[model samples]
Target: MSGQIKYQWRITKYNPDYRDENGYYTLKEEWTCPSEIGKIIDGKEFTLEEYLDIEAKYIDTLIAFIIESGLNTLRILQLSEQKISTEDRSSVLYETEFDELILEEDKIVTLNDIVIISKMILRNFVHCQLYLKDRFFAHFGWDYYMYIGSSEKSLSAITIATERGLFVEEIDSSPYYFLEEDTTRLVQWSKKENELGMNEGDEELLEFPLEELRLIFNLSSQHPVVGNIKIKIEYKDFFQRYLNHKMDFDKYEYFFWGGY
Candidate 1:
């Protein structure tokens, strides 16, 4: 019978080491360690059979966990053969530690569970300011108003939408969709000439506050709606429309930037 094979799985910490004169690590501002260079924070050897089982089940979920946990990268190695691999080692192997994947009660949570947890948190609680880039079109002489809700207000709106079996995209094309920093968003739009069919007297415009439009997306984590929320303005006094809708000024405020 052949000897048992094993594998070493490690997570590299992104600690930049930029030394000055004597090879001592310098200020954090100066450090820009290469992606390949990092100290292994946690790891252990697993039998080949054990590793195979993990690869079959937790590999993808574990990778998602690593990214969500703010880890730099994962490294996997064949201990028996002394082979090293990084990045997309699918042709060779893949990575994330089993230890770090565990949740309370030793319950292992999938990427979806993590997303639900985040939405639940934002739904019940809130932070002061959530800065977001506004991307929409407005015509001159048209009135506009924003639904400047707190993160909590956004969550409540999202929860209502979710219960109605609706995704934010179905509710509004450019609804308040907040994406993670690393996530890339590709948006495309097509317009037919005269589709708007604007009449001469249609100069006045009013933007309704669909509180249900705030849906956060993190496709990386497998959560379409992760829960962060934004909106627009024409005249300053028009903000009273939002307050008239029962929005609490003490907890939220209307804010925006840029003009066309």
Candidate 2:
């Protein structure tokens, strides 16, 4: 009998200090697609439209699962923030114990539940994003950590991996900036090439909205073996069209990839 195939959409969070002898750490929450569905084509390049077709077909289902199962935990955090804001207006000192707050059936929630939900949302988002954008994936033992805080408060939230860290970065900016570097570079290059006749420094790189960044991060982190993947497309007409129409094609040709 043949072994059953398995596929997974996975995203991971790593302990910053969890390094091996070579300075590589284990990535937590690695998701994979079910083997039955098979892997994406290894080296083929798809047009932006072609990739979006795949995402439109499959991403919603995955996103629905994550939103339904994982969003509640995040909601709990939102609720906490709301409560804090309300208390600030009344000048009430916040005194609830962390354990006690979490235990209250109506107020407190489990970190375990939040972690599970976060992982689910992240995996689904990654799968969907990869399907829509061209991307290059690479892997090494190194990871990045970021601390997110509101300018109004001393408290901060930290994200320990590239995907989550980038998501946090995009919370205040646009998502388009987070697309595959090739797309961004191409867009910038195209812009520069067109503005060559203008005074130096007259052109700026195109900017994307914050939501797009969140979407991209959510989508890129879904795979376990990302290093072998990349989406490279030839933009034969991009330069000519940019000059002729003064329109940007960079927004359309996004790509991404990942690895263990």
TM-score for model 2? Answer: 0.19
Best by TM-score: 2
What TM-score would each prediction reach against the true structure? Answer: 0.17, 0.19
Tens digits of per-residue lDDT, candidate 1, 77-111, equal 10012132443233222233311322221123444
All candidates: CA RMSD (Å): 22.6, 21.4
The Cα local distance difference test for each model comes to 0.25, 0.26
- For model 2, how does the per-residue alpha-carbon lDDT over 219-238 read when each residue is reduced to its tens digit? 22222212211123443243
Model 1 ranges off by over 4 Å:
1-12, 19-90, 94-187, 190-210, 214-260
